[model samples]
Target: MHPHSPDESPAPRPAGSPRSIDPRRLRADDLRYLLAVSRTGRLVTAADALGVDHTTVSRRVAALEKSIGLRLIERGPDGWTLTEIGRAISDSARVIEEAIDRVVDTVEGQDSLSLHGTVRVSAPDGFGTAFATPALVRVRRHHPQLQVELITATRQLALRPSGFDLAVVIGVPAGSRLVTEHLTDYTLGLYACDDYLAKYGRPKSLAELREHPLIFYIESMLQVGDLDIERHLPGMTPAFSSTNVFAQLEATQQGAGIGVLPAFLTQRTQLRRLLPDEIDIRLPITLAVRREAVTHAAVRALWAALRQEVAERADELLLE
Candidate 1:
């Protein structure tokens, strides 16, 4: 026979070895990168968000695609878009991330007050930072043994059960298992920066606001009020709009336009009440807690602290 070539002569296989192939290994980092791409929609954007270079993201994504044997993303003139496989992976990754966060929160909650376990609190983004955060600081001062975690997101925290020990929710609590505590009910009103007020003089009525530039909060769910303009204003074309209340407040402060803000947030800001006498948009505030967590020492402490804080500042927190 001719000299045996390596391809012509098969090497002995190990016992119980797969005759064909094995599934490729998947890693947490791969999942993270994939999720990042899904969120940002482009290699450059994803890389920047992850604090890596575009080429690195591109290379890692390519490797991940090969390992998984599927195309995860598609490129187009508009931007990078996720394929069905990519979307599925992203959803799975989010579940994994939330689970991991919950475990961490639980573990941290076990530490001493200085090292005490962490209590995650969620609220409307603006309210969390401006009001809830300061109140949290006060809570920490009183109970130095507990750690408080604050999560500020515009979206409702209904995705995962018990994701938070306590949440300062706007409107009524929906789930039956949740214990709802009424924090306060207040009206929403149009506000503009002092500078804007000085320049435009405040609009005296709904009809007058039609001529003024309008800034608006782009909430995922809009609950219009009884006032004619208040009900219609969000539907009206906005000159400036943002999902972030803080951004809206900043734009209003910079004299961009009038925005509807909770009376509590506006009270501390330099923005002046516009149409204060005419606009009456009521928004109810409630504190929600999982029934299981109500008796938790940390949760009860926070709930009591928040109640006292809001109670003491009720006049400033509510519309006159």
Candidate 2:
């Protein structure tokens, strides 16, 4: 008798042989192609990023659109414009990318000491340089193996479903999809250098501040939150407007004006509090992270460390 062959004998079907392949299923390459196109805005550029020929990109994109039964891109004189569905797909692809990163990190043991990757953090330029940078120093003392990339900009960096691992944002996060953790409560207090205080004396009341050269953060230049300075100090207007808190702080140090600074960033400075007994302007500081990125052990550890640091230093942070 001939040797039994597995393929020669018909095996019973598992009762699902006629099931059709889902037409809407998206492949990794499809998302990669779509995201590349969105980023580069040209088929040739996208193809370069993907290390493929322009024709390959075109063909694959056509295949993806056909598979999904939607026209994703509209070619026009303005180059390539994404259709409504294209924009939606690009957004969804970003979420998938983050989730994939988390999965890879998990599989690679992100919590292990061998875990080494750069965690990008976005923060306001002034706060990042003066305050958050020091906090990173403390974090490094504990986890020397880890690396952090701090992007300090006056404007909010492009974040969320596209870029950045975490962002230290002021005030409550708007979107429900984001994972926001309360970092600390910030209390804005009027402060001036010792010399300034000596020259002008401390402002005992809101009216007293009018005589002092009042420095304030210019509302138009702020990136993170609303400038509610008027709410805190009724009828109070500034003599000097600055786009940066650190600039205002420096100006206050030189006796230029009374500056309103977050207590956390000002505690170590030579600047003395004005009207310490009766002034209070507190806002909640929250750390916002993309929900999909939270599953990565490195991201989780960094976030946990940040929250713990904030909590540990809450009293100092709040100036309570």
lDDT of 1 by residue, 7-82 (tens): 3233345587644423455566767677666545567767776689877777676666655655667764435655
Cα-lDDT of candidate 1: 0.67
TM-score of each: 0.59, 0.64
Give the per-residue lDDT of model 2 (tens digit) for 1-320.
11113332323334745434354565766777776665444677677766899877777777676566556766644356456677677757765655665576588766434334445676766557755777776766666656676776544423223335677877776664467777777787888888877776777776777777778877666655545566677677788888777778788888897888878778778888878767777877668785545654556776776776666667876776
Clashing pairs in 1: 108-117, 108-118, 109-117, 109-118, 110-117, 111-115, 111-116, 112-116, 113-145
For model 1, where is the 10-residue window of minimal lDDT? 1-10
